[model samples]
Target: MQGHGYAQPLKRPPDTAVLIFLRVLFVVIGFTCIGFASWAMMLRLAIVTRKSLDWGLFVAVLAADVLSIVLLGSEPGDEIHTAGGYFGISLLLGTLVAATAYYLAADIRHFQRLRDAYRAQQPMAMPYGYAGPASPYTATTVPSSPAAPRSPLGPHTPPPMTHTPPPQPPVPAPPQRPAPARIDQVRAELDELSDYLRKHDGHHEGNYEGGR
Candidate 1:
């Protein structure tokens, strides 16, 4: 007799070390993010100290490659031969490196901006001996004098100065009444006590029950 119902397709078990490798991937990603932040910080330091060895970026890139090995594993798989998994893995890895470089380029630009701002704040020294382009990567020249202002239209007059109006004092707030006057209700009972104290001219009995 034919089967009564269609059999369910068996689910493929996850690859061994799948969870372990994925955990490593997450850890590496976290490490990479921290390393990127550190590199950015170090780049700022390099700009200030005028030194080389951006070890942060170097270490982060190296970690990213090692991380891929965790994903790709050491041995060739059956799928590697049939489905071009090897080529796919290779391409994927190349893209990851390129992406990291592109992302770091922005970080580098930010560091450059910070450096320019710091340089601008400091007094400039004249070219004692001609220092060439700061570095090969630096596309633009750092001017000996501060950058000259450019008018959108050639040679425009400066706009007239405007005074900032004095800040108005905040309006005096009206007195706020207590939300529900339970205290006020009790105040009527205390009115006699207030009158007694006034008559006594601030003299008070030391015979109260509470301890000193």
Candidate 2:
């Protein structure tokens, strides 16, 4: 019992004084700051694969961690004497935070580009929420952009092209032509008119002489 008591007093407990913020950072940044790729994997957005993770950013993050350790004061009353050091820390943290946004946007655009290229190759593929393929007149030949807006007709159909019509001169109506009478009908009408005129000729002459 004496030996056990003496050993107990000499035993130093493991240091558990690490801050909660550091613990969270350890979980997020991982052991060697290679968690960016791992983060991509966990989120299922593939901005950086294991093979594609940027070593440049890795070095930068590693350097920032070192600088943060050297520049930051651990004690409650610790202070930085130089304004340059404060500016450096601020700039470093801001860049790191902005990196997250950059990766997010890159992942989304990469997904869009790959999907459009695939659909362009497969022409017949009509995926959900798919608009029609891009047009030839667009700046890009490949349907890389989200396809043109879908019309009521269907997603496969190209959007309607809007343009002004060319002006045209008004067309004048055609002139009406009189109908020709048959030769026999015309001869009969003329003979009838002549006989009627001969019958009324003597009466007409007598009225003219009386008037005179």
Candidate 3:
């Protein structure tokens, strides 16, 4: 299974040596809880393999550690119930759980880093035209041009252009009536009176006509 292209082993981190020490410590503690000895080993293997089942086993081991601490402090006999011994065992179990949790978290982070690096190293797929595969088997047909539209009468001829004259402005009509006849009669009367005065002035002096 490890031979698959995508199934390369995770690179060991700088803190792997510390994790190994913690794993050995956990195995020693597992001896105290014989029921959980197998489970503790399974949990370590799951961590190494980066399996989803590891979380369930980790929880089970944590619960087992808690129970072991409780049993140590609450044993039936007075010999096992010493305050100092109970406190020491409690401290050791707590440390084991803490170390296991730290290692699991660090391993998960390292796995994520490896996955990210692998994805970054992979070359992106080229688009359709840049360096695509040749298609020699496919037919290479040239597209045909569209035919010209035909007229119903005879050989196709463009419609004749007819010239349309622009509209002319309307002409103004003459005045409806001529000047009034009374104006012409008044002018002729004024000219006759001036002629009579000029003819009478020569016949009589001005002072003689006024005395008569």
- Model number with the top lDDT: 3
**By how many angstroms RMSD does model 2 differ from the true structure?**
25.6
Per-residue alpha-carbon lDDT of model 1 for 1-212, expressed as tens digits? Answer: 87779755433433436534643453355346533332333343344335344444445545655554544554476445523446445644564545445444544454556556665666677688876556667567666987788755566777556788899999999998876678877887699888987867644434342434
Whole-model lDDT for model 3 versus the true structure? 0.64
* Candidate 1: segments with Cα more than 4 A from true spot: 1-67, 77-79, 82-84, 87-92, 124-212
The sequence of per-residue lDDT tens digits that candidate 2 reaches over residues 15-123 is 3343334334434653244323223222332323232455455555556655654555442345666765576567556545555555445544554555566556554
Q: Candidate 1, clashing residue pairs?
A: none
lDDT by candidate, in order shown: 0.52, 0.53, 0.64
User: Which stretch of 10 consecutive residues in model 1 shows the poorest summed lDDT?
Assistant: 36-45
Give candidate 2 regions above 4 Å deviation: 1-53, 74-85, 123-212
Which lDDT tens digits does candidate 3 get at residues 1-212?
56546856444443556766766676665656643343565466566766776666667656655666566657666565577557646655664555456555755565567667766766797887796656878757689999866755556676556788899999999878756897789889999999999888866787687878
Of 1 and 2, the candidate ranking higher by lDDT: 2
User: Which of 1 and 2 is the better model by TM-score?
Assistant: 2
